[model samples]
Target: MTENMNDQLDASATFSIELTCPIGLENVLENELHELGLTNTRLGEAQVKLTCDLRGIYLACLWSRVATRVMLPLTHFNMDSADDLYQGVKSIEWSDHLSVHSTIAIDCHGTNKEIRNTQFGALKTKDAIADYFVEKSGQRPNVEKQQPDVRIAVRVKREKVTVSLDLSGDSLHKRGYRQQGGMAPLKENLAAGMLLRAGWSKNSQFSQLVDPMCGSGTFLVEAALISLNIAPGLRRQYWGFKGWKQHDHRLWQQLQDFAKNERVSVDDLTVTFQGTDREQKAIAAARENIKRAGLTGIVEVSLSAFQEHDFSWQGSTPLVIVNPPYGERLGDEMALISLYSQLGYWVTENALGGVCALLTSNDQLARQVPIRPEKHTRILNGGLECRFYLFPVVEGSIKRGDRQQAVMSQGAQMFANRLQKNVKKFKKWLAADKVSCYRVYDADMPEYAVAIDMYDDWAHVQEYQAPKSVDEEKARVRLMEIVTAIPSALNIPETNVVVKHRQRQSGKQQYEKVATSQHEMIVQEHGCDFIVNLKDYLDTGLFLDHRPVRKYIQDNANGVRFLNLFCYTASASVHAGQGGARSTLSVDMSNTYVDWARRNIELNEFSDRDHGVVRADCFEWLRKSTNEFDFIFMDPPTFSNSKKMSNVLDIQRDHVELIDLAMARLSDGGQLVFSNNYRRFVLDSELSERYVVKDITAQTLDPDFQRNNRIHQCWVFQKRG
Candidate 1:
């Protein structure tokens, strides 16, 4: 072409370059480019355009922690149709960048009228490039989608296209130190941007860094690299420039050597990094990543919960950066309120004069931290809109009074006394039966209406919905007192106490999940082990009141084919399996409960072909199955109109048909146990006349349910002799 064009194609010559990052990080990327001595920069949406030489581009790729890709723009043209795109792409001198033998790939973005989809645009661009090479040298390079020799990036906006040569083949987030990350891991570049936003520097006043909820040590590793002046891209093995014709291999090697020499050892660094995570897998992953990053002893990580971890340091104020789990599903956010509150309390009480930066997607959860953020910035992570809050940790700044202890009223004290008395009463029975999961108190006192249940070391408190005659503020205050009294009365930490408002449920609302924390543990009840989650759902997987019913099934389940219909979590089925039932089948409509049942069965070492779980309507399954069961148990919901069901179910109205279906599946001497929580339910007289029906409600009531005798009604049905 021209002499000026030849100079522009040279590796040492200056040209216009663009550095792209996540959308909200434009300003951060600009400042980073300035730090790299490329000052002639203009900011665009998600990109920073600048004029720099090839060495400057290499430096940007090596050191720019926030930028996702470093691109060198070749040309821009207006497009009216697909032919115009083809012509514009073909006009470029392709030989200067790569030869026909090299493999190539195209990544197109921002479709126009001529290109309605990204795939079509990428295909058209590939055709143009292939045609250009074919016409020039009578041969065309092959297309490689995974790892191409040379990668071209094309962006179209408002019928205008910009073609650039991508220098960073993979996204800059792959720092090569992390082999795996925990669920919903933060991107490495985003972590670096967050660190920079929190004002973390090598010579800053902060001498220590702490992350209480550190998942896989992203923030700690990024912060250590930044403090030691280590280049982020040094560990990466591949780049797009390696296949380009004009790539300067000698110059790139020199840059790498310089970066290696410039990095300081962790011993010379002043800041000490510490991290703690509640999950063992997370801690293991973090340790492996830290070892990979060559900071094994320099950065320390431990397996500890957020509420129990110690965040103290011996020197100046520490900067705490936390990227806690923000809950991806609908009900997940409800369980994180206490977690955020604990975080805020720790930062304010323990880290005075320090700074804290928190990242979360839920605004309500963020506001629960009891600290007013000095700055709040909106950012996008993994396509979820999130906010990064920067708080200057100071004393008495938020004015949240006395979070350490709740002022208990006289009513609360009475409730606490009742709780103590109930525990004392159940102490002998619980120990004798080896039952760790049981109801301690069931609203014995009218003024403080709450039911307290203990599962191992944790306490689950559910408040009954107050009447309309009760004042709202008074009810709220009473709830606060109840929550505060529960931990002290039960001798458990406040973090182990889970609180939920109990209300009358209809249809599928009772089965709906209230939280997504999935914090589960194994608890022993009646010599059987079952999984229970106090924080995630309205009811723990194990039904405490059904201890007697499960005991009956376990006592009578020898050598019989057992059937458990409407088995929520299949706890009864587990008991039957342990009772030596020849074969067992558990059926439930909800997929979540079915999966939970599978886990329960597996936990009890009953995951064989004999014990099966089916996710289907119990009514439908009973009608379809031809196999007979010798022992059957059916405990349907009081009322349900689930869309998945063929017909609505009302316990009082449909008990005859349900009982008949279960009886049809029973063998000659098989006995069917029927139960429901409908307090006002009455059995049909005609069915009682047709079959031998006997009320077994008294036998099913355990000591824990004796105080509330009407909690459930039970009956046993069998054929006449």
Candidate 2:
């Protein structure tokens, strides 16, 4: 334990302090105290008992945000009844903490009690203190509830009463910036606590911070203040110690001077903090709150929808903290789901080396984002069960070769061993089920879990487990053995086996370039060819998950004019054109990708007269093009707020509008296919009346990615004749 010279105790000074914290957060508080090297600590229900002279109390008050109140514990005694409570209160030496001329007040609450009434307990305790003073000094202190010199509190829990003096006059949550309220304003202390728990620190030069859904700017404001070493309680006008008889004026002045000197100017730090909200009124309120905190110049607030903004951080790794809508209220669930899906799209498109901390109560919405978070912490906000998920953004597209295959190879071995044992049990279970494709047993047992999908003579088996360490070569070999054993266990020959090793990528390095090429033309699985340029990217091939949809296009196309909106590589259009379409037009914003789409059409041997690639915004192109098409494919990014596009695109929320636009260009009896990658997609119920909607997820899922249904629903909507 490191002793603070300033916090040295004097034997002549005798004092007891009571620290109050949130009920369930006592463990967190205790760990903090332990880290601070505070000695002789005792934990009670929502409180910690520590004895220190004046210096310890000051240190605790200055640094501990979790402590609701720092108190001087005057007495602790058994109080079985009202009479006992009154007698116990009278026995305390009140003169030590309160002057005869000062006003006093009593507050009391009971937990497990013989005296169940809190009002009766407060009145009895007040009487005992008042009568004792009157009898001894011939005068009693006035009871001032609003503003008291010495506030005494009695807490009765489980047949025990502990009396203490409140050192903090008001709740510690009043950090003093919020003069007016906005929608869903988070408590100041709770916000600070959340940031601290997330391991954010001033030492790290994280210059950029953004809160896309900044409701009341709680996260942004706190981040700024903490980075600048600003005292959270400096703006407050009162402390509970002001009324105490032994309140040291010299010590208080010294502490204030230290706090002022330690304060760092926000301008001195290269910190960029901004918050945005869709509601103009909320943005205005956040601006006002930022100004009140004396951080107007350091923090910026804007009226912007989350899906319509592109976040660019100029630092090494930016931190984005967002508390999105949780859909607790009716009519908000659908909107929130749409918002979350769009948020995921934005994260995948932009945000490199940046970390995102998304706070959400819905686990389903959290899964809508394609990438899984590295860590998650369960927290409570106003009785709502929420999780703070942390994801680290890599620089480029993720590839199998970019990852350390050694680790994955080892991980695969362990996964294979687990698969072997599960295959034996699954074979027995398969005999009972009449349906061959149905799920046999789906259970995750930490280190090992298996899911087997049987199709005809062939079965696709996937095994999941934690990745292996760098030097675990033996584990890798053992994993291969286990994988080989699975076939034998299932009564299949080793010659009929196909094995794959999958490694988890590190968040920061997941997207590095693996294969180098300026441009490459590759044949698709179905014999059609598509061209991709990988000079500036790691991925030059098709996303295999969309194989089913491409096949759908090829099977249905014949003498039809096909329109592909938001076409990235134009793979679908090439397939449509190869399927004997009269002509195909592909629209995309990226000129680089538009060229690649043109190459794909040429690679597939589709004549120039039958295919055309347009470099323009898809939505705008769709609105202006008068040419009608018999077939249309609209597979826009799940969410995008790019500068090139005026309106943000959210598949779940804007699908109806997008379908309407596509329908305008569809000839009578023309079919429009809409697809998205949001894992937990929900179609708008109103669309059922306009066009036939169907969930083609089961049909679209490829064998390579079997754990979850990655690609969303593919609905075919035909224009009414």
Candidate 3:
């Protein structure tokens, strides 16, 4: 039987109530119910069932920040068919629970094969209740869909229907504070759950919270509310019990008044919250939301990047939380890998005694975080399965079998020693020449047979494909040892090191990709930027051997219209753009390479209209293009057999035809610089009849490649004058 809203009740009387929450947070909700004085509580799947009085139910609805709904059960009965459901619901004391003047609604769940339609079941239950009320009085209570006074809930599971009255309307998760949450914002309740799982509570003496990647300040506002002892439901105006026929309005008002009184009154508090972001719009939205939450100046927010965030706070270790960008559409595991690894590295190096939690839905990317997770909790963020990587901000205690315990073999030791000696020898030279990208070791020891190039702080290791006579097992062991030795010796993490196999190619095999790491980065050469991918292609977009070649073009490209053939990444055209060239054109056979060239130019703040990247074979393009140039930098591949090309290109056999085709488009006094890497390429002697050729191969050799002058060859040509 049910009582009226203002009906007096025994303070000690307890009733059956069920609390529903997110699946993984049942334990948290259980503890919360215990704190609210609910007795004999038991956890069931995504719910907690307890025995509590009307006041207990009111407090559960008013104080619970994690629970979604609070429901009070009326009865449990078997229902085999629709009539059984209707009769079972009608058997309950309808007058005790509803008034003919109050509006009502029924929410049905589950389905029996006999009564498969939920709406149909709900309609029958509604009829049973309305008819009972109409018979008791002259008219029936009206059915209201928007907000009913008495909300009925019937759940069917295993042919047993449990009828309950919902006491929390529109879900208790909505705190009514958010107005401008940014893209993919984390729900307020989920954010609070994350804080609780990360060992946060208002009872703590002193605490601080910082979300460096805060999108809309959900976490910060939740933290502020928690620290202030403010109940989540204190500000809400309506609930499921407000308009009920037997609603305990006085009891609900008492609960609300009690919760309001529990809020921390002191304006100045010890607890603090801060947030930082890279987007100005996100920061603005977060500010507006914070103001809506009445935490305007309490929670500090600024536009700061995680890279520049200060991990050190004034007092004890603060909790650092981050939700890095992730999704399937965001291509390349490399970016997320690098980002997580960087975040982990920063935590290890900076926040020694602090606590950090990272929430992400990616497992492969989670492995990329350098430090191991101490505790992982699975939760839902907007229905996406995500995990909280909880760990202390300290260096891991190295396990014996982990990478930290790797011991070098004799072969690897010798290889590492040689690399160290080479680095030592070129350290001063690289600095003097302003070289941030260079080949540190080019097989100085024949047995190692590997070329190591350093781009800024990262090392790219290329192993020569061994001959058939070499033992495969022995080579494999040696390569593993080398990988272990390189990162350890260079004092960089293993994630920063990329490995590749270098071998002699047949036809166009060298241009293909082995893996799609998409680990692209920008390296500065002569004050200009070029994109390089360490894992995507055999050749990292920029050619370190062409350092001097680009410098030469930049020096002579002033006020000239430039054209680049076989412009792999437009590194040379970027130099031409830097040299005040009015406009430029570049041609390539691969669309991938053309896109790479466009990114390189844009990265250096150059427009793509004047410096356009065209995807076309130079052979076909040189014959068709009417665009004339005052300067031409033509560096063709030694050989190519692309199926997309009209004809195969072999530099040694077809140098004359390619040069003749290039010379036709050049202005009379313009310079034509031709380069190739074919070790035995011989310029045709007959070409001296039409133009004067000057071999600048020796002059264009930068200091880095002087030891192997055969790495490339170059020639400058001009029309006979």
Candidate 4:
């Protein structure tokens, strides 16, 4: 009888099968296999190995929503070369698996030193299959790429070759009904996994599922498919085993009929699903996919914005699950925080006891929602670390209060006392100098390593970088306490305090934006008006430490032509204009800041005067200028490689050339004020020899900054006439 190979298709035929899924989904995939009756399931890296009968394999291919592929092992052998691979594969009975007329395709992965290219291995395997069929029947099957009748998967790892038949032609996530994928579409299986994680099932207690911001209806469609017991694979027209000679048509037909009988009518289902979007195009795509799945009557899609979603449900309030678009820029997230807060408010007002799950990549923006998440499940979505946050609303919520207490650790009280003491110490200087912005506290306490600068009534607190040896939780507590206690000590509102992470910064890093609240306030310093963007950048436009230097410029600028180089937002120019300089010119490389300088000049009515702002690199602008200045305030960055500059500026290496250029532009007996934050900066010997140099950095420190004179260095170079 030759023990006919056709018997492997029988109900009891057991074979080694492998189910593959994306990383972090192995446990979920294993659980799915267990539900499908796969025996002896063992989890591997991104794969699950199990023993299943032919019927079990069929069921797995037809029902697995999370698996990428179902593979039936054909043969495995030790191999070190392409010839060994061909010989190993040729031994398999090609006639038993494929007919001469059927086409085949090989997908090869992994490699050794000798076979580094996957295509080379695939070609060798394909040659072996074709040669075996030709040797048996004098004709070989043709190789087809798109929708091949038989798909062979080959993996070469650690000098061993594994060859198998891919039972699913394409990745199982491509459930053919997904005809319209919106921007950044979540894969169908991933959507199903999300729903499963959300505890949605045939016996779910929740009566309705609503995706108010649903894009393309993947989540709603997956929910509908799960409730209706419709096999997602049934939408596809072909299976890898259907063309094989060993396939049992009658058994597959029976399995199909069983799956068909398991399908429940939409009217008889306990759960209902609805998807909505503000974009009509997205809604149209959802309808197309729903129609393709033949669930047009079961699932509903509509054009509605989150704002337009009124609490107009018929029965119970649905669990609101949403995936909002997070823009791909720094300041872009600022706008979405209000939108998320609106979402939280909507869920709280409409569904008091219901659940809301939000998926966000930014924790800062999540905090703005004002609804504290009880559960934060970490998931890797397309390699971006994401959190599926679950929040439950209740009356008189105190969970957030508990979280605040927990976050503010034992050192909170000690940090608060340190801030109060610093406020008392700096109180006299703040009023005596008429200073609205000054560093009141700079690391006064060891536990709270933060610097607090006051801009009018607003407090800008910068948390210094903690050491690696310090406990992260302890450091977090210190930061929380510093932010929490600053407003109380300063008599300012909590919202008026701006907190930012402080590290050693230079060049454009200082200009990198943090938030976009546009909380600009005009603060007075020495009777000069300067606009401060407290929420936008690491630095406000006004530098509190440089108060004395700006004061020096203001006190000596009468009837003088003042030049402000590297004029970042032109705070120094504003001081010059306030000091009544006869004419003023401000030059900077950033067009954004040059425009800002223009705005500050307009604020003080300096624009109608002789003062003007120029957008140009100071280095290039100084070289071409024919005008000489009586007072030139040159404050170049430590180093910058901005694309706006033709040459990279390294203050230490280029200070000689920079000094020479500035000295050449100085009028007779004119003083060119050069300053930098480089702690170890040295005055150029040639410039000191050619001109009179006075180190004014010591005298440039205001009473508030007298403790840290190294914050900036100032040297006055006057032309020797």
Candidate 5:
């Protein structure tokens, strides 16, 4: 027989045969094939050209974990049109693959001139096969769309058509373990791919593996199975061999028995797999998936917040994998950034000697994490382009000393360089502007760096860095040195500049410096104290960028009832009340901040019953409040995932609804100032006819924050009566 006929005969009669490997990593797959003793194989793009009989197919399906799908080549032909496709497909010897009564499905994927549409190509191919069987045997197989006995895949690339029998039957990723779905559950195949990319192998020395944001336990289950050397396909009920005419029952049985007998017990291994989530429902889903994977005994699931959970790895370095909620699925970029920042802190502090891989699509938000990822890989998850950032946590005495030295070495120079750059930029910008009273500065340099403004002899500087711990005292001293140097650098008076610090508090004892300042804010603005507390929140009390908004409120607040939702420190309300609003109500949830708002109102001597500060949920208050206002300022938190609140408020998703709600509470021709720091806030077009909205971001932005519009987008919404 010829080479083709002999190969066909070998495939038809033999119980075992070897196959080729996939394209990009043919060498690696070749090594694996050699180890498996399968010598006869070919490699192609995304597919391994392999000649395998039924037994080889069975073994490949059960043992080969890296392959996406295993396909047995049925035929190869060239066709120019649908008619040619039908003629060529009908000529294939279908009897060897499927019987007249058996059901079959055609999955088509193609590129090039002949077969452009995959769906149409699949239909034509199916028609050809069905017509061939009917014309010869007077009977045809039924097409079962969902579960077919035999699945035929047609790939028509570059005018060449190759037909293959899908030996794996179903997608190999469906290892038949997962059942419950949670928020953004990791796909099993993608999870496997990630682990493989992370250099995880059956013999790798991974002591502990964890998925902190595990949704439905995909990674944990896969880790357990891999550690135990369990055949991924053993749990699956059906296989492609059952439908093939040449399937060898005895050989398939032997392969299955071998897989079963060779299965290694992970009990003796030092590896541990665990999953945790903040939601109890997600934890429950994870538990169910673990049990379904027969990994209940091996994998542990817990309902614990990732930021709070203590990761203990028994002195061995651990592998931490996390699929954090991207802002697309989870509302609010700001809240997600804060959460990621906290996650970074937790991982750096606790996972000493561990490695963490974070998957996220938001590059800007990812920068918020303090820990710098040493390696990054691009991957796609559910069509969302994402980057997998790998961070190696340093441990031991050497690591500690290195970290200290690194921080100390960069601390002073970073601050000094940023200060010098900002001073130079500010001077150049101020010289060009006509307004002598205005000031310009770089604020976000060094990420938490602050700069100052000195306009009309009033110095206003916003402190942007938050102190993490007592060790930041060194940074503070360096900041002071920069502050003292700023006057000389900018040719401004030293006595004129004032500083503000911003801090965020989880509770009373859990205070962290969010951002600090050397000389960013003036001691006073228009004779009013502009200094904001920076050591306690994400932002200081005063948003310097919204200076013009405050000015607008101050200019137009006479004889009006003002409502301020999400009134952090009530600076806007103070401006409105001081501008002689007939009545003002500042609504916020934070008692600390509401108290601060009250103090701000008191400072302006507007703290009357008319000028009220209500500490309650803004959504609840908005729904319940009957008081209509002539001027309303609705600037909700850009995004918050607070469990204490009724709903997670996302400005982008809920801006129109918020505007509608504020409009309901607005008097005829009332002015509503809606602001958000979401850099990409796109106003809904539907709101245009009912209200006139103007982009006031340029007008509102303070000179100090001119470099980066971190605080962005303020709009004046006037209801057209």
Candidate 6:
């Protein structure tokens, strides 16, 4: 058998081979096969087909890093039923490929109407092989699943079936280095693919490689092996060809010896590796994996967070790569935004003139990174779709500390000039009124459509949604320009700016918390104290546009019972309490806003007996209450379909009904104030005839909101005598 096998594997004999890999890795696998000297190649979905001799096949199994399996084709036929499948598999000369003494297993994939499923197909193929051996030699090979001596692969695509021998006994991703893996650990071949995509090579200019979130040290070990020219499968103990009639043992041994000789010594390696993880257990696992891969001294790991990790190693242009938690299996996504931001900041500060690559499954989290990646590719890791972002840093560019002095584009400089002028105009009023928060710009330039609000030293930049007619790439570039100009124009730190996309929101979206950072602070407006959170929600606790309306309520609140409806965070209620109102009642349906209102009341040191915050739908509460109040303020959302509400509220459609409900509980001599931010609201004509109505929209506009008169509309109503 051995002599015959050797003769069959001569220089003129070649076989058609197919290498299968994970989805999105076909191109990488093809490149690896090319490096292994397999020339006649064709690419398919998640696979590469090639023509190579037996020595070439053995060489690929030993050196192809990104291929999951190396398979040698045996036969191809059409099968419409189970019997056809059995006969097709049996028709292959089984004795030439396998002996009765060898143990075999069948790995099947796909199915058809007749095959039904993969398990049934595998079972039928196994029986066919067993019956063939029995009929030929009067004996059958035993079936082995775990450690099969000869593994046959049977794939059915509708009526078409292709059978091959899995030359790789086990998946090539099991590089034999990782005894255990951490949560959602990246497969070794996938890691190698990512490195290739990021342009990491032995002959590349990068002098060092680092993985800050190095779970089990997969990236570090793979990087070292690739740079050292060590064959990935050199340490693997078994192969499916071990018992095959055609496997040339002497030729395989010669290939292994040549691969061993090609490997570079640790001392001669040009690139260095470093890794760190916040979890001690992960560091421990990475240490074990590094040692197992024979890279104890060459690669090092320590217990530290990515931010505090020592990136000060002496080298030419270091490469920083990380696979941070994507918030899928670990924790809440809102909190992970800060983590990505910090990682981005670290890279911008430390990785000058090098490269930074990050792998994440969340798109929202990916945007939190301050710098925009030049290239991003879609890939899959452990069945979850992910994006691999690559950012190349040029020296003396993109350092966060130097962002203020960085050169700006022509349009961005114009935006900065306009912002500075607006700040200068507001300086006197802001100082005299002691207002710590106010809007500085409301899309003054048509090209740059964004609103800039200043809360002391911090800037809240909201970009209005661009029209569909506009190019998305152009809009994105303009928004980036606006954000980049704000910090330098306002003389504030870049980290103090938060950017959000703004569009028309319906239902409870306006009140929903988008992030868990909870970056809140207190600001004073007209001698009234209030708590404002700028990050968690769409609208901050205090609406700067309503400053004049709240002031009017406070001045007239003296010696009156004040009724505050739809009181979000109760900022107006706080002002009324400070104005010595006899008592104040605030109502809202959301529990989150209700709790926030109570905290604002407490912040003002108001007595609980005199100040009240109720969590109830204003419409329902008004219908149930018979009590009358002398002073009332109603501010309803433009549109809400909140589940807690008894009915959807559209201010434009339901304003008449809502006003009547509030008026039923209003005292005869009391003044009722109604306000809405809807730009196109028209009051009912019949209400003007029933009660005296006055439009106070013009009077309610403060200096900061004078440019946009339609920011809000206000009206006062009183019962006719």
Using TM-score, give the best candidate's number. Answer: 1
lDDT (tens digit, per residue) of candidate 6 on 452-509: 8888888887778888999976886677667657777898765567777778988788
lDDT of 3: 0.78
TM-scores for all candidates: the values are 0.74, 0.52, 0.66, 0.69, 0.58, 0.72
Ranking by TM-score: 1, 6, 4, 3, 5, 2
Q: Which digits, one per residue and each the tens of the lDDT, describe model 2 over residues 276-377?
A: 888777888888889898888788878887667655557767777788878663223422433565565566555667777787888756754545577787
* lDDT tens per residue, model 5, 1-721: 0011224745346432323222233444444454466667766544555554555667677876556677766667677777777777777778866799889989998766767788889999889888888887999899887778888888787767777777677777788888887978867756765665565667756678888889888888887776777788888887665787766678888888889987777656678887789888888999988888887778887888875676555655778888888865211343354456556656677666877778888885566455667877666677677887877776432124322122232543455456557656666655553333444555455543655555545444555555575356555554544443444344554334445543332332222343332333323444354435533344456766666687789889999999999888788887787688899999888766787788877777665688999988787777787878999997776677665578877778988887887888988888898888777778899898778888777877656566676567778888775
Give one clash count per candidate, in the order shown. Answer: 0, 3, 1, 0, 33, 0
- In order, candidate lDDTs are 0.84, 0.67, 0.78, 0.78, 0.68, 0.84
Model 2, residue 604: distance off in Å is 52
Q: What is the Cα-based lDDT of residue 334 in candidate 3?
A: 28
For lDDT, candidate 3 versus 5, the one ahead is 3
Scored against the true structure, residue 244 in model 3 reaches a CA lDDT of 56
Supply candidate 1's per-residue lDDT for 183.
71
Candidate 1 residue 404 Cα shift, in angstroms, is: 6.9
Candidate 3 per-residue lDDT over residues 1-721, each given as its tens digit? 2222212223555667788887677888888778778757999987898876777778888888788888877778887777887787777776766678888888988888766888987898889888788778768889888788878898888778888888886678788888777777877777877787787788753367878889989889988898888999887766887775556777777777887788885465676788888878889999998888888878888888766866436566778788877644322332344456556665555555677788888875565455567888877777888888886765462112334232445776777777677778887888898898998777677666677788998988788888999887677556655655666566666557777778776445767876765778888988898889987888798888889999999999999999999998899999999998998898888877888889888998888778988999898998897878999998888888888799888889988999998998889899999999999889999988889999999998776688778988999988887
Residue pairs in clash, model 6: none
lDDT of residue 84 for candidate 6: 89
